[model samples]
Target: MGQTSKKRGVGLEHWLVPQWPAPNTVFAYVTTRIGGVSKAPYDSFNLGLHVDDDADAVQHNRAQLSQCLPIDASPQWLTQVHGNCVIDALDDGVVREGDAAYIDKPGLAAAVMTADCLPVFFASKSGARVAVAHAGWRGLLDGVLENTLKRFPDAPQEICVWLGPAIGQCHFEVGGEVRDAFLQASTSKQGVAQAFRPSDTEGKFFADLYQLATLRLKAYGVCSIHGGGYCTYCDEERFYSFRRESRTGRFASVIGLLS
Candidate 1:
């Protein structure tokens, strides 16, 4: 991983991308495979505890991350079962087993872990709240983004979303069953069918996860969206890609308010 200048009490590490515009209310970031003490495969910055990394090392890495944040609230980690379950951040200190988390209270961090699955961050245009979703293919197919949007209780146009890094379309090959599930949800066969490219071999097709996400967001009337152009599986040096390194560590995408 690369190193960038550290300032504003937020370390600008090369692996992390901070959002533009309302940078104060929607503080979002993704941790790369750097700046930690986990061993190989987990390599340095592994933030997940269930991935077989030493428990002590995971704790140390998480502590280091806490030091970089602007608030004292601990990150509300998700069990991430790859379903559409979304938790309210008001239920702090409780481990929520879900694919997404939303926080209306300032200073409480909403977080999700992933290696190649998409990490979607959400915020209201008024900057009153923010959310983070761990959208793997299953979660996306099951409506994680839609569930996250439902929490807002505001018009879809009042929200802004940022799709974080994940395995890119070029590298995400899928079978017929995976394609069928998405197709079933399609409003128009022409539009959804375009999201998949037929593979040269067998019944496999290359699916664009970002494109799928965008379609879902569009359905809910969200327009101010960004990010979702990086492939963790391809960028080995900067990300801990699970598909690339089968038995590897997980990275985190986090969002919170500044206290």
Candidate 2:
């Protein structure tokens, strides 16, 4: 597995560049909701059009992000149904109805917008392809990560992944249904059995999304994983958390192959 750099807060209008072993031909970044033109609550960098924010404000924010990408890439945003569907991002401007997308072509980017849900960036160690995933509990339970890995027929051991910001274990309280879903989602080798511990609340557990992701990835043979230390619910100044603020904005996590 590649060693991950400690995530740092990138200032306004900029991006949190994932510090990984990806080649120069591959560049990936996650936008912070710190710079843009939206107003309060959705103040500044809110990138999602589905959030009931002003459409103009969302479009303006997207434009602001597109300008900073490699080769001025336009992100292929998804409708993101929280399902397991993974698509090949072959064209731009069309929103796919899935939680994950991968691309082999250069100068085009695949991205997912999130507040507290985990944004997973994928890359081949050789820089031949890249992908991204939005892994909330539903997607995780229903096999979103596995579906994304299916897009790459190569040995999963050669794939490098970085998990972006999300609600961490400390605050991700879930009911028995969620725990049972995870337990029955995959085999024990995937570590689903250990991802939850009984919370103080009766019949509830504090779930570990990062740990769950690691188990799923390793189970699929992806050995090089990084960047799971961020807690979206805890970092109010840098990340937007839906759990913390239901009416808040969303940030974007993007990955693309470069020419």
Candidate 3:
């Protein structure tokens, strides 16, 4: 995986650009908690409307995001339910119910909102297709990534993936049942088992989401993985973390082919 670099946009200065070798026609960005207007807790630049932030503020922030994008089209957001639902990208102003969205043509960007859950970005090496997925523990185990990959016409090896900010293994503690569930669902039981380690609590383990996602992608033959050293819980100033603050807002991870 390559290191991600930060770029300064007009209104959003701290947004991240995936450092992977995506084609010039493909554009991807991960917004941080910086920029925009909202009160504390949600603060500024909170893109999630479902987090109880003022709807107008979120819309304003969203408009700001759209204004800053290189493309003219707005991102198509989903009514994410932490399930494995994947859909084609649509920006008709209707919020679709899906955890992942993809598009083969340009114009519309696929986006997912998250505070602590993983956001995975996908782009074909040829820049003809792109997608983004919201993968929490439930969604990941339910095969959201696989479903998103299946929507692409390219083989897994030709797709490039980038894992966005999320709660890292250092703070993502889960019970033994969660660990067992992952192992039971995986073919590489031993390899997947390594992503979890015993915590101080007897029945709890620290789960490495980055490693788990990488393993899942590799299992599908996707080797061009990048991004993922961000811990939303640890980086309080830059990201919003649900585990850190139960009533926090959500940032967005968006990707699309440039129109």
Candidate 4:
């Protein structure tokens, strides 16, 4: 896995720049809960409008984010429903309804907002394609990653992925039924079993979302996986966790090909 770096310039210091070996034309970033205008629980960089933050504040934060990108880049934002829907990103100024956005055209970035849910970044080795997905457990179980890959012009092996921050296993506890659902969804029963460890309570387990996502990617023959080991719940200063705080805001994971 490659180490993710933080932007150093003024007003962009807290943003995360993925350090994977993506082609120079590919640019990917993840926003932290820093450098924005929202207040209190959503304080700072709250990117999700659906989270009940003041609409004006979110737009201000979004505009601030936009200034950090290339001059011609237009980010495609979506109303995420946590399903497997993936759409081709467009700059038509409409907020589309989907969980993932794919872009092959230059200057159009694919973006997804998440608080605790895993945000996955995908790009082709050639850097001609890029995508971002908002993968909560429901979306993962529903094949959101698979659906995103289907939009790529390249094969699974030709794609590289980065697993962004989420509620790590230390804080991501799930019921037996959740574990059973994943087990039922995969043929690699033993592999799937490894992603869950029995929590202190009976009939409960601590799930490893990163591991589960990696398993899913590997099952599809994608080998160049990177960027894991971040804990949104633990890093309160830098991330927002829905499980940690019921009323909170979302950060964004965005990727695009430079024009």
lDDT of 1 by residue, 151-193 (tens): 9977999888888899998889999889899989778667678
Instruction: Report how far residue 111 has shifted in candidate 3, in Å.
Output: 1.2
TM-score of each: 0.93, 0.92, 0.95, 0.95
Model 1 scores worst on lDDT over the 10 consecutive residues at 1-10
Tens-digit lDDT track for model 3 on 97-119? 99999898876787899998999
lDDT of 3 at 19: 87
Writing each residue's lDDT as its tens digit, candidate 4 over 88-152 gives 99988789999999998877786899988999999999889999999999999999999999899
How do the residues 133-204 of candidate 2 rate in per-residue lDDT, one tens digit apiece? Answer: 999999988889999998986689888999999998888999988989878767773477688988988999
Candidate 3 deviation (Cα RMSD): 4.0
Specify the poorest-scoring 10-residue window by lDDT in model 3.
Answer: 1-10
Model 1 TM-score relative to the real fold: 0.93
CA lDDT of each candidate?
0.83, 0.84, 0.89, 0.89
| Count of residue pairs whose backbone atoms collide, per candidate | 0, 0, 0, 0
Work out how many backbone clashes candidate 3 has.
Answer: 0
> Candidate 2, residue 199: CA error in Å?
1.2
